[model samples]
Target: MSNSNRTPEEQALMTKAAAVLPGGSLGNLRLDEEHAFVVREGRGSRVIDVSGNEYIDYLLGSGPMVLGHAHPKVIAAATEAMMKGTTFFTQNAYAIELAERIVEAMPCAEQVRFVSSGSEATYNALKVARAFRKREKILKFEGGYHGSHDYSLMSLAPSGNTPFPQPEPSSAGIPRAIQDTVLVAPFNDLNAVEDLLDRYHDELAAVIVEPVQRTIAPQPGFLPGLRELTNRYGVLLVYDEVVTGFRLAYGGAQEYYNAVPDIAAIGKIVGGGFPLAAIVGRREIMESYDQGSVTPDVYVPQSGTLNGNPVAAAAGLATLEVLREPGTYEAYHARAATLRNTLQRLFDEAEIPAQVSGIDMMFDVFFTEHPIVDYRSTLVDKTLNRIFDNTLLDNGILKSPGKLYVGACHSDEDIERTIEVFRLGVAAVRDA
Candidate 1:
């Protein structure tokens, strides 16, 4: 755990933490010391580890810190709201403001319901879709993670070889029977989805997808085609914008594709590093929660203790304010494009079989010469991913263990520094 033989103090802390945690060992400290920057704090693109090692950060808390960690404005607003009131179970002015902001930001969001996390948001969206269609079956793309809920767990594997109209649970503890309620379709395979829908149209409730395909962006027009199919089939189209929201654009992926979903599940950057998420959709679909509904008994009951908690909403509002700023997105995204271009050029010059793909604030480095169009493509190589993992972390610059996200806080200088680190890391792996 410690660099030069573990100091007594370091040993004590490690032992204590290990005792309390299940995965006790520190597995992958990319930096040689293995103590690899624990982290005292972060500001802008740089993070100072507990050991006092500072490095430019591209991990960006998986993708939420678009404005970067602890932006002064976000911190101040959260602080002010915390001072006024951390939470008040009942509705408040702050909540209304946050809702208005989300509604304005999402072109398709006619109504918004706040929740504690992306999982909760997606779960509720699934429920809303089922209820609206008065059906039980939900369709989801392979390898699209829509949170850990049982229904969403089905069909996440890229292999369509799993039986038709159903799939085994991607994770244990999820009942195999739940798979019957989920229909699996490959990403970007419109023909496959059409066939599945034809078979299960009557029972199909919603078809959910991630526009950008996460690690790979969908080929152009793929999203529009999906939208058209869903509409024609009378199935509610749900967009899981958890990672793409605010990062792809202020209005999310929907804006870029010029297509709107019946329901949109949002989280990530909207929370500004806080725990907040929401399901925004058509008014009728969202209004099913209205008190004294015809079948209040049958209405979905989704509530969490921390749903719309004041502090998270305050942070979300502050985050949105920053995102809403004119030209803010342009400045940060330009930086990201530059980084991607530079990195791609570096890989090309090195003659590495690799390609990079992403939009706006998020990108993933894939070590494949072939175009990775979807999850199916991503499954082709395992060792290449391992090579990427080892090399990137071995250097001082830290990124997501897998997918990486750059933040608004990252400057031109930060991008250049990361490029240099990346070149060295790649060269190290090549030599090794």
Candidate 2:
């Protein structure tokens, strides 16, 4: 955990990385030099840094390592698949099998189309909706991340001066024309969504949302209300289930919440740590993808060279097979509940003004007294949150600054040790 122990080999790589890579880091995450680490290897619930320092991994490859790193079943499946061929650039049996699995498991997936990433899934989902409805605009919640695409980048981290439905571009490169197509509203606020849908329904193609936006779960009627509104307005309802897909339940959030959308995008655990994701929906909406199924005006063409690559499909199929086994979800939720409740109690006992948000599978504590329901509410104590996260890293727990993913592979011992580390993290926050 200390740089003093870093081997010359490790230090040399860091120097080389800095010379070749922008910001001396992968764009995914940046830690200060004192705490920066390059992952050497991962197995089960732990990751060993390049310097051989081990930490309890809570990032879980940013949420795809649900079965844990290099799971034997996943590895075996991928290896077996690789032996056959890596990529055919055409339809493969593994792709068909994985598509069948997704259609069977996901409530809204009557038909499934594969893509190479979650961003592609969302982007394509939007395209399909627009093609189907003959409308150009879509609504997304503020702070709800659909991925790094131009449309998704709007209002993702707005400073909050902008009013509802007005967009703020999170990144500079996004075209100015994109701002008009995306409308932003508060998460969990059904009224705002309804109002926007009412005004924009004629121009609105779909309403895309993360069922659980970041760490905030939807209030009881939120998702169902969205479904009702979208149906009434004749606009497609799209769930960006990239974070909640197979991780939430066997059927994902659509089944978990009993709120079926017209279409959905799924990724993360569905790929089993590989670069595979999908745009799935009703047969009618999904029909847009087939060049022969629709008129030229409405047809939406989508294809990725690596879409549904066999190795990823094999790993995904294996992961889903294991997930379907009885008691996997129950056991996963039980451990998650323990971690959630334990952290909340620790925060309370320490007299920290904290609100733990998110579902059991993934959540984080916001260092604030206010309830966390939207992006603006979460900014109440950025300084405190920043210190708390760094404390977690200092104590050897790797996690996203925004969320900590709990995996089925995390052992009882791992959870116990993590609790001890969580206490250390909370204490450091208290002292700071």
Candidate 3:
């Protein structure tokens, strides 16, 4: 299905949007005019465009809508909390409860500090690590996205062979000094990380990584190796689990992989589709956030007005309760696995040279025969990826350009329709 014809009202909105917003869109997505749409609303694994065209939503609000759009339980919780009041600058009961839940659920969390976004969580996690260790430099993996902060932007999507441990700034405004503070290494390459730790441990505060580096699963021994080396170096290990937390498992990647880091940043599902994120770690490490607990020199001053919005926390608590239901994860995994395998099979049967990469819960096609083990390897067939994703949109399937995020609310009908879309998508790619 090419995009349904836009109504006059929608066309006017797009024209208005073009005049007002940068790039005529959100920074996250830019679609061709023929395929562009403004979402009217979303419900249970589906989104309707302003033109009244419904799409099977694989984007899932970029991976936060795990229970799908407007889940009843979350709505009720948030609505009730909204009735009470939106937010208070002072401590609130719901935030405390949510903090308790995070500390209980996250393997690395003995204490937690709330924040308003995943970017803030990662930035604060790094700041706390620096405060604790009295060190300035941090090591992050190539292509590991930790958010848009200056330190996190280093080598996020560098295409150049800049050699190991050299930071590459993908964005322009980042100060040149940031390149000196952040070191880059390849994901899943233990030897490179060991070398960097050996040489720079004295100045390094921590090593931050995405355990599942943007849909590229960690190789056996990788996470353990990172934990061991960071521990040995007396440097912190921070897992940027904003995408993987609760999405991967109830306790996040540290629990799923059985390799715990010193601190972790969590977001997405934990917020129940709201703008809440958290930084969690061991009690001693977390003391940096408590001015009274830490010496003046090492104290981290962090405060946000909406850090613990009652409505957001109530919705998150309700979401976590729903996720705790028996067999919920199994069902979610099973549906995702079915889609993953079917898509892989579709590509194979169509004789298209592609690899279905990532875990069942979040995966996508890499249009190449080569195994996708790192960011550099993923560069192969980049053009094909663009074609395939655009084809999916043409067929009424909405997914992120990089990953297809699955949610628990997908019905049998949704599954069947998505699978049929997969076949058509692959075939279009095969012919293209």
Candidate 4:
């Protein structure tokens, strides 16, 4: 890391975190400068920074922690699990129980294989799709972040006639060959996908899409159209439900939108804020990985030394138990509606070209008069968007800056507080 890139405190942690983890992706905003707010602890919708500043946390760890930081139920479950021996490396009862909850929650998830993170789930889903279809290419939407894996890295530039959409690695160190096997299409542009399918459907194994684009909602019929079109093309459809799973509803956005995919990759709230994820789909496809199958045509070997770890499964089970309650989703919808509407009205009254994009508990504030229907539309007015992000961060409210996520723990008071912050933040940014 550059000296210019690191603050004294950041420099110390960067040295440690980099030595251990890949010095995780830093935001585009100058983190060490104005935007750097080191978190110490959290309770409900508020997080306290190291400096002892309490901020209403809308970032929500980039959309996990939906029950919010250290919910009593989740914490207790984790503590109990920890006390009962952390990792057994053997199948645990909680694993089966959590999988049962997932199967019940996601209408499309018939059989599930658990993993540690969203990236692993999405990556494994790609492998399953290929094995099922016996194809080579994977069609992905531009700017759709499935994971840090090779195939999901291709990003379409904000320009026209994007060609040969091989995986343009989103990060350093990914092999360039990934770009060749991965194809890119603009989100919501079904015709563009058809154009590519004309030449490559036979070779295309799967088409993965975020039912609701992260930070943006899909236009009506967009997701169903994608499902229909992919089914028509014999390409496996994978819905990346990492952000929209329980956050959208008990059954996820696929069920909420009534667009069932061949496979579903889920993360976030499923683990009760623990490190867990899943790739779930039809019985036929998932059964190919069953070890005892005679002459298994597609031998899919999936093992995470920590796959289906007991403690995480226990936490996940506890989280889903609460989410499954009657009217649980209803409360999330009502609260989200209040927050989105209040923010939208604030932008309107301020005469700012800002719009809130979300459904249920997830949303993003785009600083544009026009609606952000897809990734292509997200790039317009980049300057104003940057200004809007900085102003909100400066006002002692914590949002993702890319996409702010509301949670089950975000109370009515939190909504009011966020609206107040948004009003001041919007005005401050507009003037600046």
Candidate 1 worst ten-residue window by lDDT? 27-36
Give per-residue CA lDDT, model 4, range 25-74, as digits (tens). Answer: 35432343345655669988888765566778878887888778888888
Q: What lDDT does candidate 2 reach at residue 120?
A: 96
| Model 2, span 295-352: residue lDDT tens | 9888998988999999999999999999999999999999998999999999999999
TM-score of each prediction: 0.92, 0.98, 0.98, 0.91
For 168-281, candidate 3 gives per-residue lDDT tens digits of 899999998889899999999999999999999999999999999887988999999999999888889999999999988899899899999999999989999999999999
**What local lDDT score does residue 202 receive in model 3, on the 0 to 100 scale?**
99
Clashing pairs in 4: 166-179, 167-179
Which residue pairs overlap in candidate 1's backbone? 39-49, 39-50, 143-156
Per-model lDDT = 0.78, 0.90, 0.90, 0.78
Question: Candidate 4: where is the Cα deviation over 4 Å?
Answer: 1-32, 156-161, 164-167, 294-296
Task: Give, for candidate 3, the lowest lDDT window spanning 10 residues.
Answer: 1-10
Whichever of 1 and 2 has more lDDT, that candidate is 2
**Candidate with more favorable, higher lDDT: 1 or 4:** 4
Q: Model 3 lDDT vs. the true structure?
A: 0.90
Better of 1 and 3 by TM-score: 3
